[model samples]
Every structure is written in structure tokens, then in C-alpha cells.
Target: MSWFSPSRLVPSRLVPSLPPYSGPYPVGSCDVELSAADLPSPGSPPPNAPATIAFRLFYPAAGSGPSRPIRWLPSPQKAHFAAYARFLGAGSLLSTAVSLAPNVLYYTTIPARRNAPLLHPPGPAWPVLVFSHGLAGSRNAYSALLGELASHGIIVVAPEHRDGSAPMAFVRAPDGGASTSVSYQIHPHKPTAEVYAARDAQVRIRGWEIGVLYAALEKIGEGAEMRNLDPNLGVGGVEEDVLGSFVGRLDLRPGRVAWAGHSFGAATVVTVVKSAYYGGEEMGGPFIPARDAGIVRQITKSSVLALLDMWALPLTSPSAEQFFEKQLPAYEPGGAGGKAVLSVLSEAFWRWHGNLNDTKVVLAPRTAVSDDDEKVEQERRGPYIFYPEASAHLSQSDFGILFPWITGRVLKATEPERYLRLNVRAILQVLRENGTVVAGYSPLEGEEPLDGGGEGKKGGDWRILNPEGGVRGWLPVDMEVTSEDRRMSIGEETGGRNDEVRETEVLGDVKL
Candidate 1:
């Protein structure tokens, strides 16, 4: 066996045909009421200007309580404007109104389809979900998924990661002149480790901020209606505490909290959960009254229920095994003195488990094989199979953030709406595990039953089935690669013109 330097697999940019580069919209702006008089007519041009890439939100009605919103945060790739336009064009069926309000987000509190009157007040507390944008992305990247989730009962928070989002600055080309711009945070000599380190730092920081903000929102509640209208408030400076409080103004339960970020945001949630737990630990058992320690112990046991990573890859893979085996000195077992918290944190995101119980896991591209897999066919290109050189960006904190862009280029396009409807189930699973509501008959009408794997099954019941088994959409796809089999690639993109050789070394039989 031989060792390879870690710097050779630097990520390179592939300029796809241009797409719409919409910025993050304010969470308050989405307003689509089909019953309202301001809707657009079919086949007619939009009566309103297009707002920042559009999305929808749905929550339970008054009696049912507030639910989470599924959020769609899109990457800001300027070239894809046309694609976005087409998306909205197709999405009109979900709404009666069409407006392109630049910089303004569109939000609506809708009830799920039960054909009931709108008299019931929503339930007391609502669960929470946050959508994270990818590198060089804005907060409104995935309108397809966001709108669909909002249509249900989820409170979705999409945060704009400051480190690598699309900037407001731009060079306007002269009339009929073309403009060119590079991706945000682009680098010549990309260090995979440095990039991962930076992303983890940024996402964790943002996640903590998000948690704080949401807590504040719970306190604000209905006060938002009053404060939201004030003319003096600035959009960016509006106290997150105030915003948090305002959203929380409605009397409700904190319910369950869940975070799902694309790309780096995914990594962000994982870090923040650990951070929240760590912080809670430091706070000394929740400040309970002298006798409440017993209750506190049980309560704090599983504060965080589940973490969902959409297309995320571990930090240093197949390679980390050897580095631990040969290069790095071993730590004295269980020695707090040797276990540096930050170092572990730096590596915290290097490897992650989407399941609450770290052992059970779900990896994407179920069909995609890694270079280390037995059927390492060079021609096959998809996540099911991994290629050492292909996933150069795995080192970055937010891996799924690039889902839209990456999914756009390499595979057949799935309607964003369809994907959202399917993905929300996984989120609900997280909520259920967190002690939230059970899957009501209404929400589970079309859901499939697991053959042998879920709560109902006894032996070897991992088989989950959808109502339509042949076309099951979002089930977990597990791969053979474990923490021990993955490796890291370091180096610049080789053969500038050659698309084939993208890495410095290929570690076979190693976990991806």
C-alpha cells in the first residue's frame, strides 16, 4: 500500500448553461391566497414582477397547531434564470397569483387538504426545520421543495450562509453587453481540509444563531403582526430576537426542532446539535430546582432527535484510517486531556450519522458506487457509485447545497414538487422519533408499509414500502463504504482539457 498527498483533489468549477441567480427572500413576503382577488389569469403574463426566487409555506390551521414549513433555498447561479422561469411557469398550478417581487419572500399559512372550513385555530406549538443554501447560493435555491413543505405544516427557516453565498454586488453589463462573474469563494489552490474546516466553522456558527433566533421567535408570537408593519424597521437588522419572538407570538408548543441544510447547512445542523447538547451540558443540567435533577436527566437525554443529511459526504474518508494508523500519534484512550474539543469539532463534520442512533445510517445515490467498490466502472457517473476524483467537493461542509446544480447537470430532472412531497416524510419521521405527534391517518394515507423493518415489524423489517412499491421515491439508500474505507484526494484539477483524470490518487477497497 502507498500513501498519497491530500492536496491533489481540489474542486474545480464546471460552467453550466446560465440559470437564474435569485437572492434570498425575506420570510415575511410570501402571500398566495387563491381566494384573494390578486391572482394571475391562466396563459396571461404575470401581473406582478417576479420576486426573489419564489417558494410556498404551509402550516396547520388554528386547532391543529403550528407545523413546520418545508423551505427551498436555491443556489444563486446567474446562468439558470431561464430554468427558474420554467420552474415557476410549471409551478403556477400550486397558486392562483404570480408575482416576481425581487428581494421579497412569499409566505402563506395554509391548511392541509381536508376540505374543512377555516375556523379551527392551529395547535399551540409547532416543530421547526431550517433550509440551508449551498456554496455561492442564496436562501431561495429550492423553491420546489420549499413551497411544497410550506403547503404542509412545517415552519421552515432558510438561512443565508455568509461565507459562500451569492453577493449583492454585481457588474451590470452595458445595454446588450454580456457580463461575466466567478463563483463566490473561488480559489486557485484549494485545500480540501481547509475548505472543510472553514465550512464547519461557518455552519456551526450559523446554526447556533438559528437556534437562538428561533427561541426568540417563539417569544415574539403575534407581536410580529404589530412590529412587522413598523416602517422604521430595517430588513437585515430587524432583531432576530424580535423576529423569533414574533413568530413564536402564537401560543404553541416548541414541539420538536429539526434542521436540514443542503451542502454545508447539513453539516451546520449536525454541528449545532452537538454544540447545543454540549452547551446544555455546560449549563449544568438545565438549572433545575434542587430536587428536579432526576427529571432533568431524562429530559436532556435525547434533546436532539434526528439529523438528515441530503447527499452529504464524510470529511476525510478512506484516507483517515491510514493517517490514524501510521502518521498521527494515537491518543491515550478516553483521556480528556488529549481529546481537543475543537479538533474533534474540526473533524466532527468529517464523519456524520443522519440517524439519531449513530449506528443506523442512510447514504445517498444508493446506486452510485465509489471507486473502492467492487464494481468500480469508470464510465458509470452517479452518486450510487463513488469516484475518487469526482466528489472533490465532499470536503466542503455543506454537501447537499449543491444538489440543485449537481442534480441538474448529471441526472434526469425530477419535478421539484414531487421531490418535496416525498422528502417531507423523512422529516416527519424525525419529528415522530422526537416524541411529536404520531403519523395521523390523513398524512399517511398514501404511505407504504415496511415489509419487515419499522416499529411494527419484529425480525429483519428494514424493508420500507410505499403505496406504490415499484416507484418508492425517498427511502434511504445505504452503501458499503464505512468510516474506515474512505480516503481524501488533494491536488489541482489535472489535464485542464481532460475530464477523466481529476484526482492525485485512487484508494481502492477503501471506504468512501
Candidate 2:
């Protein structure tokens, strides 16, 4: 897929377009809701009330016609547009005006067919990937990436977690009546500590929500009835449908499941997996408690996990030092090839410090773990670390790809390539290492070349390096690439704020 041309960045004439999926299969998508009567809310909600999870499912399609385009934003109604416009820092009048103008509000199209037939691959079942969005992000926020993965014969399930963390989510009543749209509210007066505590709490709740979704899959695997549940609980513009196609089509095999998340969602994956590995009490943090230990254990026991530029590591209690030295190296073999953890981070991840100002704070120094430590785990786990230099925190989602045109600022506009490469690498790594699906491409192909050069003999603009040696011999590269601190300062004037943060603050008072 070709990168967006420079001419398409004009604000008045720009129409955002997602790059085509590189996989051979066409993509099919549907929305479904899961209601677990026994699942308890992690936070202070009604205990007996059934915990509900609404998600969009993307999978490979059997037949291809003119692709069905999906709305970029979930709610295209005037009310939602006004709220989102305000959240984006538009003035009241402009927000109202933009809401009234439907053309300007709903312009982007996701290149996937809705309610298309699910394609059965050569295997007995399709590999499953559960995706969690970042704070204030919707399930469709990463539509491009998720759709790409789905096109590659992977089933991508993204839950619309309405734990008061997303920018907006359609909250369905327990009785399956009308769904109400909820928007994120900013409380600037709330103490910083209180805010952190609330975020940590939400992280745990979202993690448990993931567990509930997995349980639903298990039920489907057992041939349980899923159509009896409410199917009209639509999110954004997409309506929920019957689960008849997905009933026997899902691959719930041990080690075939992979967990992936961005930002706080990434942190949630880590928390849940860590709690399962070491008892919740031993990990001692605001969110990891004994109550969630069982759920975490069940979710992470045999699943491959991936963290995309995690934002909650600093706020968590168990240090990476403790996790790497004790749990990571001591990982016991399981269905997912001994519990592998792959983190595809961006350069700007190191500069993040919540809403505070500390550009030099290293949130994930373990990316540069010692050669000895790397060697120990290399044999057990696959390449445990990868960071792309030409990317930011939002690069993993559609927002990063479209932001350049939205704001008319061309900083790091080539990030779509970086995101595409890194995302494919992460998926391929998990699949290849777990012995689920092995394709021809190397997981490390097309990464940003670290050496000061253009394309190398390996046909990748970036270099792929191994901890034991400089570059993989198969690539035929000459230079030795070592892990370096990719963290960069935006200068004292910016006070550690990346472009994404600065842009968000400028658009609205929301603290993400």
C-alpha cells in the first residue's frame, strides 16, 4: 500500500483513507454483545447485575464484492458530533455547526465489509486476537490496524469497554432497551493522585472485562446458545447481529489466543498477565488485588500477550525490574509457548509522564535489557522487544495516520508505514513463536533501518537486529545495530508534552 501523498494534507479538501490490508483475504466485520450473568463488576457497581461487553468482530471473508465501508466515528448523530467536536477543542458554535453539517462530520470510510460471510481457513479454526483500545479511544479507533489483521486470517475482537474511560461509548441498559451514548468528562479540579487512582481502577475493570469475553468464547466453543442475547445493541452506526456465523467458526485452541492493547489498555494486559503469573498480592499495586487473581490467572495462563506503547507502567506497583528478573525469566512453558510477551513500542513512549512534565523519565528501560538477560530469554521466548523510531504513542491507531491531515501538520507523516510494519511484525511473531500459523515473511521485515542509510540489501528501509548478534544473517546487513535510548526531549518549553498531548489539550480541556 502506498503512503498518503503530500497533496492530500489540505484541511478543506482532505479525505482520510486507510491503506489497504496486505493480506490475501478480504475483511468482514460484525458487532456482538456478551452478557455474563455471573461476572461481577470490578468497581463499585451493582454486584448481581449482569456484566455486559459489546465488541466489534473482524475476520476473513469468503467472497469479495464492492467493499462495505464503515463510518469512521461510532456516533454520527448531531449530539455525538457536537460532543466530540467540543472534546476536540472546537468552540461551542463551531461544534454545533459541524454537528449540523453531516458531510464534514462523516467523511472517513473504513475499508471492510459489514455482516459479510466468515471465511474458514485451512485450519480447523481461526486464530483469535482480543484488542483493547487506549483511554478515551473507541473500539473502532484502531480500525485500520484491526482490519489489516483480520484480512490476514486472524479474528480480531475489540470490546467497547464503557468503564467511563473512552471518549464515548454506547451504554446499553441491562434490559437490552435503548442504548445511551456516554462521553468522557474532564475533572480538572480532581487531585492528581485521585485521577491516577481512578485510572488504575478502570484498568483492572477493563482487564476483567477481557476475561468475561474469553468466557463467552468458551461458551460458544461448547455450542451454547448466543442468539438469545440482545442483538440490536448497536455502537456508533453498526448494529449488533446474531452469532450464528461465529458459533462454530472461532478458534479457541490453547496457545492460539493473543491479547493486545494500546496505552492504558496495554497496561491492563500487563497487569492481568502479571497477576496471573505471580499472585496479585505479591505484585502489590493499586489495581492488582487478590479478588482479581483468579480472573487474571485464567486469562493469561496460556495466552500470548502484546503491549503497544503501554502508558500505565509507571503508575503500577510492580517494577519492570521485578517482573523481568523474577517472572519473565522464570516463565513456565504453557500452551502459548511458555507465555510470550511482545512489546512494539514507539519512540515517544519513553517521554510519556501522564499529565506531568518529565521528558527524561524512562517508563520501559527493560527494552534495553543487558545482553546476558536478553540471551537467557531469547531461547525461551521470541524477540521480546521492538521499538520504531518514526512513531508516536498514537501511531498504533488510525488517529495517528489521519492526524497529519486533520491538523494540517506534517510531523512524522510517514508513520503509517512504521505502524503497518510494527503491527504485522507483532502478529507474525506471536503466531510463528506459538507454532500456530507460519507464513513466509519474517516478523522483523520492513522495520525502520537504524543505520544511517536508505533501503538495505534486505529490502527493508530499517534494520532488524537480534540481541545475540548485530543483525540477522538472513537479512544480509553489514552494520551492527544495538539498542539505544530512543527517548527524545521536546525541549523544556514543551515540558515533555508530545505533539499528541499538545494537540489534544489545544482542542479541548480533556486530560487523556
lDDT tens digits, residue span 229-285, model 1: 211122333322223322542323322444455444544443443333333332221
How good is model 1 by TM-score? Answer: 0.45
Off by over 4 Å in 1: 1-122, 167-183, 187-190, 193-197, 221-255, 279-410, 438-475, 479-512
Per residue, candidate 2 scores C-alpha lDDT tens digits across 249-328 of: 77776445777887667766666565545545565543443454334435444567776766543333333324323333
Runs off by more than 4 Å, candidate 2? 1-14, 38-51, 64-68, 91-102, 105-107, 187-191, 228-242, 280-302, 313-339, 351-383, 406-411, 415-418, 442-512
Candidate 2 overall lDDT versus native: 0.54
| TM-score to native of every candidate shown | 0.45, 0.71
Best by lDDT: 2
Quantify all predictions' global Cα lDDT against the true fold. 0.30, 0.54
